[model samples]
Target: MKEFIYCWKDLEPISHIPSYVSLTFIACVLTCVGFLYYATNTLSGEKNNAPVITTTFVAIWLFIITILSLQGFFLDFDFRPPKLFIFLGILMLIIIGLFAFPRTRAIIAQMPITTLTYLHIVRVPVEIVLWWLFIHGAVAESMTFQGVNYDILSGISAPFAGLFLVGMKSKSKLAAIIWNVLTLGLLVNIVSRAIQATPYFHNPLMDAQPNIAVFYFPYVLLPLFVVPVVFFCHIASFYQLIFIKEEEE
Candidate 1:
């Protein structure tokens, strides 16, 4: 365990943290924006609300970025734990509220399940970014696939499963359900470990180096924006499976 924690010690830190980190950060942001556009368009259908949808998406991103910049929220590790927990708690409540409210539920139910499934493909690049961060000593080793994380598999299989289920018009809802459940489990596993890896929680099982990178600019966007969106995608999938009916084969 100790060896795994200090595995990156031998490797030299990247010479240009800003340049490479900025590239990866831009990639993540663009990927997330693309997914949101696809999802919003899928839900909006032919309502001609694409402009509104796009505006709303940009507005939300701007809001988050503005807050991050103004407050320097990422630099302070002392207050990060409570802030993150509170943000997560509120996010969960909002997700639950969206599902529970009749109007919002109907809106979400209109989204294509296949699109939700495909959205998880973003996780592939997310894992890759995590690996890069691990190498740079920005995050802990345990957070990557090389250590305890295996969430990347879900991202890899998502395209195939989505294609098979949607393209083939398969009636085996059970298969889709199983895949969603398994992937959801993987998401939860990594998220739990990530929380533990934070300096505040500091689980002994995790690496000695706490996950400090996520609290900084650009990288902080991962936890605030990307991770929550992925969680919502999973929840939205489950909701569709339970209440929304599939077409007859």
Candidate 2:
């Protein structure tokens, strides 16, 4: 377990942004615009199955990546690199079931089981591993926090992901509103904190800023990408739950 820390630390890819207004920045910006477009439509209460799943998966990945981005949170223990074997194993089982029996996919596809947020349960272990990595210095500082501390936002993948799952599963418009509001609230709050901490983001350039590492906005607002998708998921999930409720009624 102790030796794993070294491996994890090295594997925490440090690919630099190279130029602030570089290709990576352009890509991230485009991605953000795309997210806003799709999420805006979804928030308007459009029901689309493919978009919902795609958004949910993107939320999961973004949340996971953010967690992975943090560095040196853990200093006292030996951290190990996490392998997603368990997830893969479970995923394989789910896949086999889907192929073996049509009902399996049907049952799995059922949405909004309840307020318990089961739709994102598959991601629980990933968050756990990330937490352990943070606790042991396996991961490093984020473009968001610059220097991370043990706090609500440090191990954000879980609760934030939970928020996404919750909003997606809810049937109330109030929930969707709350989800979007929180998404922006949390995003702005964290970005402000990161900017305050990191000199690079002292004066952020909106779309016209020079090509810089923190210029892409992910370093400032790590949740920007995930939040919209998650917020949209909330709308889709709510729509789903309402439909399910009416069917039961």
Q: TM-score: which candidate is best?
A: 1
Worst 10 residues of 2 by lDDT: 207-216
Model 2 stretches with alpha carbons more than 4 Å out: 1-180, 191-201, 204-228, 235-249
Please give, for residues 39-141, the per-residue lDDT of candidate 1 as tens digits.
6676654664753665585668657764874465544444534676666676667767888888777767766777778888988988988888887767778
Candidate 1 clash figure, as a count: 0
Q: What is the lDDT of residue 32 in candidate 2?
A: 46
Using alpha carbons, what is the TM-score of model 2?
A: 0.27
* lDDT for each residue of candidate 2 in 66-184, tens digit (9 for 90 to 100): 46434333222333322222322343353344435654333323533232232222223322332332333322233223333222342343344455534445344455445435544
Cα error of candidate 2 at position 129, Å: 12
Deviation of model 2 at 116, angstroms: 11
Candidate lDDT (C-alpha), each: 0.72, 0.36
